[model samples]
Target: MSCLKLNNLACGYPQHGTKNSELLVVNQLNLTLNDGEIACLLGPSGCGKTTVLRAIAGFHGLNAGEIWLSDHKLADVNSAVPPERRRIGMVFQDYALFPHLSVKDNVTFGLHKLSKSEQNSICHEMLSLVKLEHLGDRFPHELSGGQQQRVALARALAAKPSLLLLDEPFSNLDVDLRRTLALEVRNILKQQNITAIMVTHDQEEAFAFADVIGVMNDGKLHQWDTPYNLYHQPNSRFVASFIGQGVFLSGRINKQHIETELGHVACDVSSSVSENIVSENTETHVDVLVRPDDIIHDQNSTVTGEVCGKIFAGTSTLYTLKLPSGTELLANFPSHLDYSLGQEIPLSANFQHLISYAKETA
Candidate 1:
């Protein structure tokens, strides 16, 4: 059975001059999260990623549709459950720790409902889960940012909630720590088989932590797919532009190949559109999505591109290559092979399967 399900849920703030006239932050959103699956809602600011999380947490009532947690309908009509009673755990961006409470108390606060012995045992196990068993006696103010966040996580998990909602939970930490904890938190969640939905605008975080990702734009979900599918077979141009690093090069398609200013580019989607163009006698325009790794630098290759810019990125070097036709492409090379700016380098595309959207023909 699905762990959490949202059917055509519409949630938003109210605006003046109209009865329920406020623009919907999340419009007719529909999705089902399987048990133990971690999904993420990814988008820019005001795109309703957090709004969706709040709605699922029962903090906000849905304007339409139904939500089910563990096969139980969650709606206003059915004696709406309060946040605490919903068995849903939340980890906010700021960690939202109570300054007055010590780490032990903060983690044990929710355990007050249980017997003293059970609560003590649960708290100890929770502390150990986050690897901060020794720091349980310390206050939130005394611990490092990462430790504080882990306490917050442990507190949420201690409740043994049916579902967990994390709203940009790693945004407060530094880059390196954020990456490390995101994976760590994912492992912990999986170890507990906790159904979780995390909200974030960071693609790397979403991809790293989530089993599936729902890419949102404006107030609608563009696509809810695995990270690999969302990255390689993006349903729309918006997702292609948003998910990964790349520059779109316009191309025209014939029977089995795309003819662009760069050259005749081969693709995996060639067969899908191959026969359709034979009878049309029209060129199908497309945007070739090329990531940095797709372009290989070779001294003897036939393709020549000028190095317009370079950024030393430790293990790898990112170079912005400009083709003779003024088309710009990014290529990443090992740090050992440093190519100066303005130097012409032979470039070859190693993209085995390219995703391209048809222009003027769709």
Candidate 2:
């Protein structure tokens, strides 16, 4: 069952120094989340991902369209439910816990309507769920950053919200800690069957935490898909560039294959070329998307590139190679097989799936 749905939702803010003028931050956006599913809105800064989150949380009003939580209507062009009235919870980036309050008190803050006994019971349950049962009596200042975040999550979940909104909740933590906490929060949400939508600029975090990811650009949703599909099968040039590390290589589409500087590679039946351009009588010029994993470092291959740059990444080394035509490509090679700058290295393409776009003219 779909737990949340946004239909043609448009949102914006007032333009500075202008009267009755608005600047749209989210335009004609549509998305859906299944029951207990976790989704993330991902994009670069100032891409309106946060605006969409605010809109869904009833912080911003819509210019058009509707917001629905199951069968209940939350907002539309003419009407909106107040934020407090909506059964939605928010987890902020700063872990907005009261410094004076103990962890147990923070989690129980939203259960004011319940009896004292109920609040304490729910608080204990939430603290246990977040694995912070031992720290219930400690104040926010006494806990580590990760522990504080867990407390914020516990507080949000204590209300038993129909939907949870996380606004870059892990951004303030260190990289390693962010990843670890993201996994922990994901587990907690999954165990409790919570439907959530998080807004973030980090693709790695999105990939790790979300069951589905929506990539936004310029107030528009470029793609909404699974992490694997977003990486292996992007829907647009921007999505292809934004989701992962890759470079576009010039190529010519010839029936079921694309001929590139690397070689003549067979296109998967699901490739855009096979689906959209195969019927054309003339060969089509295109820019083929090549990921680092698609490039195999081979010693006995005729194709070779000049190693221009390399970054050692513990288990693997990322090499930036310049072809004879001056086109730069990235290849991930094992750390043990060290290659120096200006060294000529043999390479071959081993694409699991092919993706290409029409050649863009200058």
Top of the candidates by TM-score: 2
Among all windows of ten consecutive residues in candidate 2, which has the lowest summed lDDT? Answer: 269-278
Please give each candidate's TM-score.
0.94, 0.96
Model 2, CA-based lDDT: 0.91
- In terms of lDDT, model 1 sits at 0.86
Q: Model 1 over residues 125-149: C-alpha lDDT tens digits?
A: 9999999999878999999999999
lDDT of 1 at 192: 93
Candidates in order have lDDT scores of 0.86, 0.91
Candidate whose lDDT is highest: 2
Q: On a 0 to 1 TM-score scale, where does candidate 1 land against the true structure?
A: 0.94
